[model samples]
Target: MTEAPSPAPVRIRPEIAALPPYRQGKQAGADAFKLSSNENPFDPLPSVIEAMRSATAVNRYPDASASRLRARLAARFGVGIDGVHVAAGSVSILQQLALATAGAGDELMYAWRSFEAYPGLAAVAGATAVPVPLAADGTHDLDTMARRVTDRTRLILVCSPNNPTGPIVRQDDFEAFLARVPADVLVVLDEAYAEFVTDPAAVDGARVLADGHQNVVVLRTFSKAYGLAGLRIGYGVGHPRILDAARATGIPLSVTAQAEEAALASLDAEDELIARVAVITDCRDRLAAGLRAGGWNVPDAQGNFVWLATGEQTLEVAPRFEDAGLVVRPFAGDGVRISVGEEASMPAILEAAASALSLLPEGHPARAM
Candidate 1:
């Protein structure tokens, strides 16, 4: 007998139903290096771990407002307590901001090949995602982004040291871009990897906010530099009214007590964490330099990762690195992004990069002249 036809699936928003879930970096085996995710390679400080241990009151719900952590961040950023909003991660803030600012028929704009989550976030919010292509050098084409702004546009996301591509939005350029944007449209500067940026000219979100750009909100995370990826603590610094709107859209009590405790401890140990960031930045620079020396057109890598523009060969080239025990994030038909991992992983990374370079034609865009 033939099986009965399956019942119609429960109604999900068509966009949500069609949307792909966020893809995480591929994990590696015990002996292999897992550099797919741009994670801090260092172990948490003893103080941070101790702080987490002290937060043993899991039976009780955490502070729904995450007041202490918000207070700390506010003081650090020299903002009023209400000016800071803490959440599970900076991505959560992005979601909240999208919900707060845009809705069905509204448009949310950002640079293409950025954060990867931007399109999904806009779709989830029932907003249209307007992605402007990156410039040839893998940086945001801010001028094009400004020109594309429509009256329906409600929110914009700017990811600096843009994910996968590894180039930053410069300060002067960012300021000029801001000037062209209408004052009513909200701009969210997603700076998840800010700590890894060593360039003197990269846009500093703190400085931008201090300059009183009311339309701007700077989102940062403890995930990258502080080794708190698992805890998921991140925050946004902006005008209180804007943050309040985002907070209203957020899920209450999502930031756990352990995460708050750990974040506070991480801040207390800032000097040590900054030093670790320096090491990773140095490793990133060396790795990029090595790739360039081998004739690969590596971009100005300001984050804890470097990009290899393997183009149509991305799928084929990624396996070469995997075979070399390096798990990297490959954007099919685009390129590969290998996070700057431990110093010990450098040799294998460089070797894999060199092999990938060999697959390119003599004068491909990914090759240096």
Candidate 2:
């Protein structure tokens, strides 16, 4: 029998057609530790679980506005209810803000090697992505970033404790950078891993917002610290007008009732949740110390992950981790990111990292003195 011919591809935006889909971290098998995604290894508190279980009314659409959750967040952040906006996740809010602020020919600026989603968010809004390379130490060079801002720039994303590479932007540096940015241009401080930060000098988005930076919006998530990754809930705090614009661009009812309930429960259990974060941070510090002791030049890991700047050896070293019952995130030609998992996983992680360090040349950048 003759084979049928394939149908013609449907028309779509060429830029989008050329864009690569967001790649999730690799999954691990039964015997392996999944340290690819920077997920909280702690189990959800019983209160949060109960809250989710109580949200049994699946027959009804969620509050389109996510009012109660917004109110709770507003109170916590000392902002008016309108100043807070809830969404399926902080990334969803990012896309909404991009759509609200920029379009074709406009520019959305971010530090490259930060969040992997920033460029895709810009592309989805039909805006050009302006990725400023990170400094030699893997932190955002805010001075250089501020200098790069142009008239066409409509949105700037600042990721603290930046993903993959983990150093944070200092508060003083962020303030200086903000001063240089045009007031009309929106700045979204993506603080997805804010709760994990232990540095006293790291930029505090809430403090910035409270200081009357009306052009700035703070994006945070329940996914990381709260162990609500499966629930898909997060919020943005900013001027009411700015949040309103984001709301205009958002999909109505995207934040589900269960997610809102779970978020509320997490907030109620903030003390307990924060205790868990301390444990994770301790684990993170130990992991970083272990990697550095192995002669690997690990960055200042403020997030729950350590970066191995494997450079060209990223692809080659990733499987070595997999063979040792660990799954990690690897950026080809750049580096590998290993999340701080259970304390028990640390021995294997350190062992794998030490073995991988031997593959680098004598004077590689990822090697420490």
Error of 2 at 321 (Å): 0.6
Q: Give the lDDT of residue 150 in candidate 1.
A: 96
What C-alpha lDDT do the candidate models reach, one value each?
A: 0.93, 0.93
For 20-78, candidate 2 gives per-residue lDDT tens digits of 88889988888999999999998899998899999999999999999998898899889
Candidate 2: where are CA atoms >4 Å away?
A: 1-8
Q: Model 1, residue 109: what's the lDDT? A: 97
Pairs with backbone N, CA or C atoms under 3 Å apart (clashes), candidate 1: none
Model 1 RMSD in Å is 2.6
Report clash pairs, candidate 2: none
For candidate 1, write residues 273-303 as lDDT tens digits: 9999999999999999998998899999998
Poorly placed runs, candidate 1 (over 4 Å)? 1-8
